[model samples]
Target: MPNNMTAVFLPGNKQVDVRAVLVPEPGPDEVLVEIKASCICRSDLSLYYGNAVISGGDSNQFVCGHEPAGTVVKVGEAVTEFAEGDNVAVYLAVGCGVCHHCRVGIHYLCAKWKCLGFTMDGGNAEFLRVPARNLLKTPKGMSHLAAAISTDAFGTLFSACRKVGVNGLSTIGIWGLGPMGAAGTLAAKAMGGRVVALDPIAERREFAESLGADLVLDPTAPNALDQVREFSGGEGLSGAIDCSGQTAAHNMALDAAAPMARIALVGENRETTIKTSDHMIRKQLTVFGSWYFSIDEYADILALIKSHKIDLERLATHTFDLKEAETAFRMFDNRETEKAVFVR
Candidate 1:
């Protein structure tokens, strides 16, 4: 392995450059991974566009791109589970395992939660160091590109569906038709739920239909809520998920949900707001803000993938070389690709 490597860094607004940096060494409980593939997530765009509040404040530039899959090159002294040459997928959310939340398997809610590529130096490079506890064993036959999406997109959807109690017969409504939304549709179908997807983009809606949505409705349509209600036999949806991160879409989700239904808010939106009383008490709705998945949940997701229950490969639309990182981010920013990846 080289002593140093080239990594993509985002210094500031619209400032992306490649530079040589020292390759990180593994700590006692961490492992150094030779990254094979990393996916471009919407959160990465937030850092590129200066929308996310990264660690070290807004002025301190950092490396980005978190969903990474690679081979373990070096293991820490205390790392007994993994060794060199082991193929793995890394969970981006890093937390101290001894913390209250971490002990209970709620790592995402850890007070010291620091996500890779967001609060720390991430996998937009040839190599990176990560906690051994966050590494997941990739399925034998899965490609690195597909495994990369499993870490974030598919994992997040799996967590959301669990939060909403999806059981094949539930009438579910999904707001947003992006990769996460589309993945949720598949998850709902896998659970035997009847899905109704809503999105303004014709292509995204069409994609949802292809994934087994009973109906696809335009969010901007005058009778969008009515359309969903009609599909649910006038009782409203059993549950809803707002993955678009739009305030309007959130309102629509609440409107479409049945009484006492649960709604998982998975996306990030700064300007979105909701009326607390009317949206909560009037409907007796349960709102859950899902971040990343728990370690136990992630393990279950991996097992499902290995069993051919989760089709993660369908979400990746494009793949690029690490040298073409700029092109990949550009395409992702413009919404030109469903999921873009950087293959090493």
Candidate 2:
């Protein structure tokens, strides 16, 4: 094992750098992963711009890649379940083991929740030391890139759609055809839902179509909402997922939903206006703010991916070597790529 390794760091103000650092040693209940791939998420923008959405956005103190997958290279004495050389994807949210949320496997909701790349060092490096319990064993044939992305992109969308009761008979509207929106499109289609994907960008709309979205529309169009209504046969959407944090997209999703429809807001947004009566009360609609999935759900999620033959690897429009962190992040931030990943 190397005594030192190179890792990425964001010094705020859109600065990105790679630095030489010591390879982390596994602590009690921890395992050191030789990262094969780490994905750059849209949320990483907060860290890049110097105003992170997470409470403790200490850019200088932590490596900044949360969606990571790699092979285990070292394990602490207490880590018995996961042996060295096991391929695994990391679950970013760490919690106090005794908390009710952690007990229920929803680590992200724990009162003392601390996320990788936010509160702790993450996988934008050659190696990462994570708690063994956070390890999700990858299927035998899963690619490192797919495992990395599945950790959040596909996994979160799958959880969101499942929560909304998406099924073969459902017509689901997905707002914001970014990586998350594209992921929502894939998940909905795999689950047999008729998908209506909306985005202002022609490229994103086309990407969604390629992912099997039944309908793709420009949300900025004057008759977009009307189009959604008409597309759903004037019955309104059976379910809707807003993957864009934009207020307009949120409004469109709520307004286009049918009575008794289920809506899941998967996008991270600070604020958005809502028409309480007309969008919710009058329609008897159910709206949920869905975040990351419970740790236990990974099994079912992977199973669904296997059963549906989802090509998660195809979602990555670009992949960069670790040295190209700047270029990778720059292009991703500029919306030049659908999904981008860092490879060792």
Candidate 3:
């Protein structure tokens, strides 16, 4: 292997370039992973559009990527659980294990938690050095592309469902049809919850239906909330998840949720707002802001995949060579694919 490798970067809006950089070395508690596949997430697009909270200013020139799966090439002396040649999925949130939140298994809430690809160099390159604590063992049968999303997409969805008290036989309303939303549908279905998916795009709605949605509705259609209500026996939904992060979807989620139901907001929308008096107080709803997954939930998600309960293979729609990252990003930006992956 070469001493250095090329990685793609978005210096500004619509400006993506591949540049050569030195490969990272593992520290005492880190592991060096030779990236196999890295998936492009909506948050990456947000960074490209200058909308993400973590930003690398124009002068800083950051490496852009987050969701990645790869083989461990080297292990730090302090890392005992993982060794060289182990296939793994990389967790973006690297938290200080000694922190109060980390001690409670809430790594996402760790004050010093720093995300890969955003606050640090990420897996858009040939290799990356990540804290060993952030690595999850990839199941034997899973592909690199499928494993790439375990940390963000599947993990996050699982966390959201758990927060909302989802279980077999519960009715769920999903407010977006993107990759995460589609994953939610599958997850809810795996747990025996019937899903009602809502999206503006016809293609997304169709995708949701193919993924086992009990009902797929256009959020913009007249009586969309009525459709959701009808599906839930007119008592509203048992729980709702807002994956679109749009004002319309957020409002619709509030309308669809049953009294005292949980609503998980996974999307990032700046202009969205909910009236505290309109439904929050009247219905006594429980709202949760899902940031990411806790390390404890990763084990459950992995078990579901290993046992064939959740199918992630169908979620990856496009794959590109590392050199074609710009094209992949453009396709993702255009909404031409569900999940775009960079395969090394």
Candidate 4:
């Protein structure tokens, strides 16, 4: 193994610094992974703009990439479930293991949560050292790129769709056809839901359509909700997911859903107004928030990808080497690409 490696850091104000640093050594319960692929996320822009989304995200001293997949090259002495030569993907949340949430594998909800790429050194580098419990085993034949996207992008939406009970009989509406909404289209379709993807951008709508969304509409159009109702056979949407974080989208999803239908809020909006008896009480809806999938759900996610032959790489519109971190983040920040990845 090399004594030193290249890592990327976002020191706020859109600065991306690629530096040479020593390869990290694993702690007693950690593992050192030789990173093969690492994906950029929209939330990473918060760190770029200096208004970090997660707490301590503005402290750009650490490596900056949470969505990473690679091979285990070295294992700490206490690591038992994984070893050298095992293919894996890194999960983002690092929590206090003894917490009630962590015991059940929902580490992100723990009180002492420290996200990768935000609070600590993450994968935008040659190697990533993380706790053994945070490693997800990727299936054979799955490319590192796919494995990386399967984390925060595809995996997050997949878990949300599962929560919404997307299935053969569902006609779900997904607001905002960005990367997350686009991934929702793939996951919803794979699970047999007829997806009605919405976005103001023509290109994003077309992308969602290409991803097999049953229908795509411009949410800004006056007849957008009408189209959704028409498409759903006049029964209203069976379920809905708001990935845009827009107040209008949230309200639309809440008001357009059928009675007893599930609604998932996957977007990162700070606050929005909601009608008590109108959108919720009258519809008898089941509203919930979904972040990353549980550790227990990783196996099912992999199986769903394999069985459905989901083309996760399609979302990775661009790929770059670690040295090109600046260009990659620039394009991604300007919305010039969907999923931008750093690959070895």
Candidate 5:
């Protein structure tokens, strides 16, 4: 193993810094992974813009690339479940193991939650040290790029779709056609839901269509909701997901959903307003926010991936070497790519 490695850091003002840093050593309950693929996420943009959504630490000081997958190269003495040569992808949330949330494998909800790439040294580098419990075993033949994206982009949506009970009979509306929305489309379709996707951008709408969306519409159009109703045969959508994190999209999702339908808010919007009795009480709609998945749910997620033969690499519109961190971040920030990854 090399004594040093290259890692990327975002120091605000849309700046990216690639630096040579010492390779990290794993602690007693951790394993050191030789990173093969790391994906850039939309959430990382906040740190790039000099303001981070999650506070309590200097995000710039940590290596930044959370959605990562690779091979375990070294293990700490206390690490028993994983060893050298095992292929794995990391779950980003690190929490106090004894907490109620962590006990249930919903570590992100723990009071002492610390996230990879935000509060800790993450996988932007060639190597990353993470707790053994956070390591997800990758199935055979799963490409490194696919493994990386499956950890966050695909996995998050998978959990959300599961929560909303998407199935063969569902006609779901998805707002926003970014990687998250794309994942929602894939997950919804895999479970037999007819997806009606919406996006203002022509290319994103087209991308959603190419991903097997039953219908794609421009949300800004004069009668976008009308199109949704028409597509749903006047019954209205059975479920909806808003990945845009925009207030307008949230409102549209509620406005277009059928009575008794469920809505999962998977986006990272700071605030939004909704008509209480009109959108929820009257319609008897169920709405809830979903973040990452439980560790135990990975088995179901992997089974779905295998049975559906999901091609995660299709979402990766661009790939770059670690040295191209600047260009990669800039292009991703500018919305020029559908999905981008850093590969060894």
Candidate 6:
């Protein structure tokens, strides 16, 4: 193993730093992962502009990628279930093990949690050191790139689709065609829901159509909601997922939802206005927010991927070596690519 490795950092203000740093060593319960693939997420842009959304936005000094997959090269003395040579995807949160949230496998909700790539060093490097509890085993045949994307891109939406109860009878309208939205489209379809994917960007809409969405439309079109209704046979959407985080998309989802519809808000947005009486109370809607999948859900998630023959790698339109971090971030920020990744 190399004594030193190249790591990427987002020093705020659209800066990308590829620095040489010592490879981290595993602690008593930690594992050292030789990162093979690390994905760039839209949330990373918050750090790019110096206003981080996670870890309280107080720091951007650590390595900067949360979705990473690789082979475990070293395990601490306390590690048992996972050993060197195991393939795994890292869970971003590190919580005190004894906490109720950690016990329930929702580490991100732990009060004193440390987020990888936000508060601590992350996997945008040749190696990553993390607590063994945060390791998610990757099954055989799942490529490093797919495993990486599976963490955030697909896993999140998969969880969201489950939350909204996507099924054969579902007429789900997905707002946004970014990686998350695109992943949601696939998840809904795989779950047997007919999907209507909406995004203003023509390329993104086209990509969603290629992903097997029943229909795709420009969200900005004057008759966009009409198109969604038509796709749903004028019954309105049985379920709706908002991955755009835009106020317009949020309201649109509510407006297009059928009576007794289920809605999953998967995107991160500061604020959005909703009509209470009309969009909620009278309609008896079911709405909830889904962040990431529970650690235990990975088994079913992997099964769904394999059973449905989902090619998660198709979501990554661009890949780069760590040295090309700047170009990768630039193109991603400009929406020039979907699911750009950093490869070792």
* Model 2 spans > 4 angstroms off: none
* lDDT for position 62 in model 3: 63
Superior by lDDT: candidate 1 or candidate 5: 5
lDDT of 6 at 299: 83
Assess every candidate by TM-score. 0.95, 0.98, 0.96, 0.97, 0.98, 0.98
lDDT for each residue of candidate 6 in 222-284, tens digit (9 for 90 to 100): 999898888888879999999999989988999899999999988889778999899889998
lDDT of 2 at 134: 94
**Global local distance difference test of model 6:** 0.91
Q: What is candidate 4's TM-score against the reference? A: 0.97
Number of backbone clashes in candidate 6: 0
lDDT digits (tens) for residues 160-191 of candidate 5: 99998999999999999999999999999999
Per-residue alpha-carbon lDDT of candidate 4 for residues 1-344, written as tens digits (9 for 90 to 100): 99999999999888889999999899999999999999998888988888787875455678999999999999999999998999999989999999899999899999998999999998899999999999999988999999999999999999999999999999999998888999999999999999999999999999999999988999889988888889999888999999998999988888778889999999988788888798788889998888889878888888899999998999999999999999999999999998899998
| lDDT of the structure predicted as candidate 5 | 0.92
Looking at candidate 2, what is the lDDT of residue 13? 91
* Candidate 1 lDDT by residue in tens digits, 132-197: 998988867878877888878888888888889999669999999998899889878777789999
- Clashes counted in candidate 5 amount to 0
Backbone collision count in every prediction? 3, 0, 0, 0, 0, 0
**Tens-digit per-residue lDDT, 310-337, candidate 2:** 9998889999988999999899989898
Please give me the total number of clashing residue pairs in predicted model 4.
Answer: 0
Q: lDDT of candidate 2?
A: 0.91
Q: Which model is ahead, 2 or 4, in terms of TM-score?
A: 2
Error of 4 at 246 (Å): 0.8
Poorest stretch of ten by lDDT in candidate 3? 53-62
Q: What is the C-alpha RMSD of each candidate to the true structure, in Å?
A: 1.7, 1.0, 1.5, 1.2, 0.9, 1.1
The positional error of residue 13 in candidate 1, measured at the CA in angstroms, is 1.3
Off by more than 4 A, model 6: none
For model 3, residues 1-344, the per-residue Cα lDDT tens digits are 57889887876576678888988788999999999998888988877776666643441366778888999999999999999889999888778899888887777677777778887778888998899988988878777887997778877887888888788869999988899998888888877788999999999999999999999999999989888999999998989888998987888899888898889999877667787886799999998788678777888988876665567878889889988877888899999988888887
